[model samples]
Target chain A: MRRSRTALFVLVLALAVAACGGTASLKGAVRNPPLEVGTLSLPGPDGREVTMKAEPGGLLLVYFGYTSCPDVCPTTMADISEALTELHPDQAEKVTVAMVTVDPERDTLERLDDYLGHFFSRRLPLRTEDFDRLSAVTAAFGVQWEIEEHEPGDQAYDVAHTALTYVVDDTGTVRVEWPFGFSSEDMAADLAALLEEPRA
Target chain B: MKRTSCRRRLAIASVLVVTLAACGGGSGGLEVTEAWARTSPAMAEAGAAYMQITNGGGADDALVGVSVDPAVARSAEIHETVMAEADDEATHGSDMGGGMMEMRAVDRLEIPAGETVSLEPGGYHIMLLDLASPLEEGSTVELTLTFENAGELVVTAEVRATGP
Candidate 1:
């Protein structure tokens, strides 16, 4: 009886180890005691104060960009759109993408709505002219951005920022950070895996 | 007098040959391929175009300017997206938020000899400013690329729903 019990314990230990190892294969890092970022209150596309929190039992993907961003911003949005398209209809419905504009001076609410409408219709386009408020929100999520002024005669400037997509769990905790350049298939897989996890 | 006239004719012929060579007239020239553009969002006033440029000749080339149809866009310019350097530590946290990203207009993009320069997303691209109309998916736009030595190369960029 003693030998049988020891064998059973060893089998149980092995299974536990295997289960833990499964999460290691995930494309995005799994946060332990996930990062606590509070709710975001900003101006929505309608120029009204809107509060954004992770869905009660869903996922929120947040990105920082501008309407005039010619390359990376659009590319990342396209990737997210493709990822949602690849998911099951029910699964896709649980995901929401909220894009906050770093260039609020030019990215008006109407401009943002027109820009985001290209990739997905369900996105939350937020903007603010207050830099301090924008700074606080970015600090919470560890996002970075800066503006590059053009020459005296030039009509445009550039805003350099971190190109990362933060995946927030339903409980308003950042669960994963998707870097730029990830494929749509990889993004979809990560989202699916996170959705399967029980809310913490 | 006859000898001097013959020398003058030779000088003129040499200048013509040099001009032709500089204009990418021979077997060695610049080639552009795999041109494409993403479909603009509804009501968007701007769009972007991407392509790969290859220099087959021995001489170096520079993409000086780009032009689109007046009906398609009001103006077009070259732009590059770059990551912000992580040097500042005062305003932003060292671990979470420091690197800021931005894009700026570029006057020229150089293509070295026997090398290929790709204008893909998250890198170099053409910014179509003030679009006359939204870019429809499955459509094509005509673009003319002007180079310092290769003159002009025209291409039809397909507007895709997404990107390549």
Candidate 2:
């Protein structure tokens, strides 16, 4: 009886280790206490207010950027699209990408749709002119951004914004955060691993 | 008269040598390589190009100006992306609050002797403004870079979906 009990204890220990080790090897920065997605209802390209949600066992890739951004935004969008291509078609279908434009003044609904659709077909274009609501949503995700003051007709103005990408779990909690310069291969690997993790 | 002719021939030969050096012949000179630009999305008014400029000669050089055809873009300017701290003080203590990236126009980019200067993403780049059309993938755009010493060099940048 003693030996049997010891064997059972060892088996239980192994199972626990397997469960915890799954996400510990992720390439992104894992959030200890993940932040909630929090009330991000914005207008999609179709002129309808859409509330962002994460389905169980699925992933949400959120990025903050604008259409006028030439360098960082395009590189990031391409990387995400490439990462999705690296995943299995079924796994890729389980993921959703949403880009929230910090510069709504320049990023109209039609403009955002055209820019984002070129990179990934499975994407959501989130834009809002209500600065107060935008601030609340960005604050929840710990994103920071600023736009240069310019005249109404000034097309050369610039916007200063963060480049961090967030990975939200099925619960709408930010599970991992990837900073600027993260490679597409690493992102794909993280997505595969996150998909395998069991939802709580 | 024969001796004078010989001397004049030598003078002409020396002048040829000087002209050869100035034209970047055998002597090491500026070389631009690996020039590429990311494909611009449809309706995007601006785009950026990146490359490495190597000053192989003994004297330093500076890239003072850049130009592209009006069909490609209205103008090209050298710019640098800088990281600025976010204004949200609430997230100040957290490392996840990555700072904001800002791009500013730079007047000159110096290429020191025997050094290679790279213009890459999140760093120095050539900002193409008022693009007449979207830079399509697999297409090429021509740019003329004016250097203080190396004169003007025409570089063709291949457009791709991502950076190299």
Q: Whose DockQ is greatest here?
A: 1
Q: What DockQ score does model 1 reach against the true complex?
A: 0.38
User: What is the alpha-carbon interface RMSD for each candidate?
Assistant: 2.9, 3.3
The i-RMS of candidate 1 is 2.9
lDDT per prediction? 0.77, 0.82
What tens digits encode model 2's per-residue C-alpha lDDT throughout B20-136?
Answer: 577856433888898999899897888999999999989998988787888998888899988975555432223356677778888889999999999988899999888899999
- What range of 10 consecutive residues in model 2 chain A has the weakest lDDT sum? A32-41
- Candidate 1 — which pairs collide? A159-B101, A159-B102, A160-B100, A160-B101, A160-B102, A161-B100, A161-B101
**Best TM-score among the predictions, by candidate number:** 2
Off by over 4 Å in 2: A1-21, B1-21, B24-28, B87-96
Docking class of 2: acceptable
Worst 10 contiguous positions by lDDT, candidate 1 chain A: A147-156
